[model samples]
Target: MPHPQAKIHRMFELVEPIATVTFSEVVNEAFLSLGMRNYWDGYFAGRAAPLGLAPAEVVHAVFYNFADGEVARHIPWVWGKVTPQEALAVRERASAVALRQQIGEVAESPGLVRVADLATRAAMSAPTEGRALYAGLKALDVPEDPVAKLWHAATLLREYRGDGHNAALVAHGIGGTEAHVLMALALGMQAETFGRIHHLPKAQLAAVVDGLRERGLVDAAGEFTDAGRETKQRIEALTDELAAPAYDVLIADELDELIAGLEPIAASISND
Candidate 1:
């Protein structure tokens, strides 16, 4: 049996995107307090702030999979405006508002808290295993706001899974720009958001894209080639494979139902 935490991680994968997608409005609002004009700038800085009020380079190192050079341009500007704690507080406040919105819609939806309960069990059972990202997210003080508790559990699973995914990518000899390119292509990332969030220079991004093309992973138009598609799929499978063992605590049926139960919440928030 895989670790119970693995099942939790998989289940959370289904729930995590909704959290991020719905967070945009709340995130934009939170950045106002941090003096950031843009959401990406505020987001990266706010997120990495927990790692420390460190330099751009230092924060980049701690950030794991981001395209470093593109973001290196602005992190100093961001860190200069807010201390790590302040940045984190702003993030939590924004998350709290978003959480409230998400949960309230289901005020009458039966078993609203069920997903949170299941995720909490998985979080309680998962081990750290020297993953810094997981540890940092785990150390965050859980919000007592009833609605926020569900978001808190979902956040933990997302971070834990992300940290482990990076570890798996590294083990496969993927790193730096190539890793970012591979992920961006494999994950079906939106071109507009990718450019904005990664902030990679055109020349640098071009070079990586050119290299991926040379290796037959992408085509002239920058879409994934057949091989590229396969590579991306493999990476995701391996990521899930690496993350799977954590769910041994639940039976397959329970995991299935948990995913089913959360679909409506995701659907409800899909347009939000």
Candidate 2:
């Protein structure tokens, strides 16, 4: 049999994009209506909304991978213009609308209800200590509608896993810029692409890449060395292991049912 964490990881991967629906055009327009025309403004504000006017430093600390000033550029200021509660409302509503549009009839089917129940069980059972963002999201009320409930559950699970992943990176001694560079290499993208995503300057990005090469993590061409690949795998496996505890509430049959319900919906949304 696969490792015990394997199915839990599979379920998490399958439903991940349910939260990505928050980034769809529908959600963008909703943010526009609230005067958050910039995507980053919406992103930081919306995700951080459940935390209730958190400072930039707090967001930066919890988010753990943004370039130094990137979170500051959007937070505090975004809260000044739009309250966290308002942003939360817009995010939940727009995300539901976007997910509904993408997933169609499946959004209302009984199968989705089953997925929501099982996923919510896992989310609610997840550990809260040291997981700031997950704790914030967990504080919210579970939606009554099946589609919204599933989306909320998926988001909770995503943030839970994200919090664990951050801990894994920290434990592995990977800094934010270094982490982005490593992910860029792993994803087969230019290091600059990740730097751009995190808003790191070219010089800073180059420095990180050079440092990685010096550490024998990446070769001169900015690709992973054997040690780098093994390190990445170790970090990911640890992340998966940390995240697995949340799903412990589900019995074997329920896990099977949950995964079955999620797979088709996830496939539909992905292909859409």
Candidate 3:
């Protein structure tokens, strides 16, 4: 059997888009599932003011902020005292701590030895994929304009699938939902795909597609227009530019060996 911690990591990886924004909620869910809710509540309460949040809002954000509205609803908790920027910073720091601790626990859990092993293998494989992606981007030609740069970066990031949300956030200044839309389109995914992969609803998916079209990022048939294609090419170029240095830093054989070691661990965790 996979360790419960492995299951927790899989859940975290799936919901990483919201991690910085909805840190408290993700941590609460993970800890609560492990029967550590009360312990966290007390710990957070003591750290709230220092973390720049009211205790209640911190707690609420951590567990209850599932969508946009939920986050908006809690705005009053720190209306005068905390700026939105500050709040995000607090959430990010707290979330990082929570995730690190969770991973540590998983690493220590005897039941998760197989899962941990798989995770090690996955990490090893990441470099090769990264290298291939970098090469693909370098092979593409994109203009040097700033607007073109933004578009290119967004498109290349979308190709990674794993990094698509980050690309979406950069391109649209909207988080998760918008990221999901861009990723889905880039991958030729449909409403059902979004539903299964990210648990998004049809209405939400429709809205995102519509928004992209309105912004001239995508077209009526959910295809990338000339502009969209240009944007994607630019993104790929940017990715290659950025990754080249890192690729040079690591030996290929080392990367492959690392991937071989980590693949099983990542697989075990996902399976769990």
Question: What are the per-model numbers of colliding residue pairs?
Answer: 13, 0, 23
Measured by lDDT, the strongest candidate is 2
lDDT minimum window of 10 residues, candidate 1:
190-199
- The Cα error of candidate 1 at residue 137, in Å, is 1.1
Model 2 segments more than 4 A misplaced:
1-3, 195-199
Candidate 1 lDDT, 100-129, residue by residue in tens = 676566734447667666656665456778
Positional deviation of 31 in candidate 2, in angstroms? Answer: 0.8
lDDT tens per residue, model 2, 200-268: 667888888898889899997889999998988998889898888788888888888888888888888
RMSD value for candidate 3: 14.6
- On residues 1-272, what C-alpha lDDT tens digit does candidate 3 reach at each position? 22233332332333232222223455445334433334333233222323244444443433221344433334343334445344333434445444334444443444334322332232222243433332343344432332222223322332333333234345534445554555565677753465423555668667776887787878888777676656655654443333232223235554344334334333443343
Query: Candidate 1, TM-score vs. the true structure?
Result: 0.81
Off by over 4 Å in 1: 3-13, 21-23, 74-79, 107-110, 183-199, 219-223, 251-253
Q: Which candidate is the best by TM-score?
A: 2
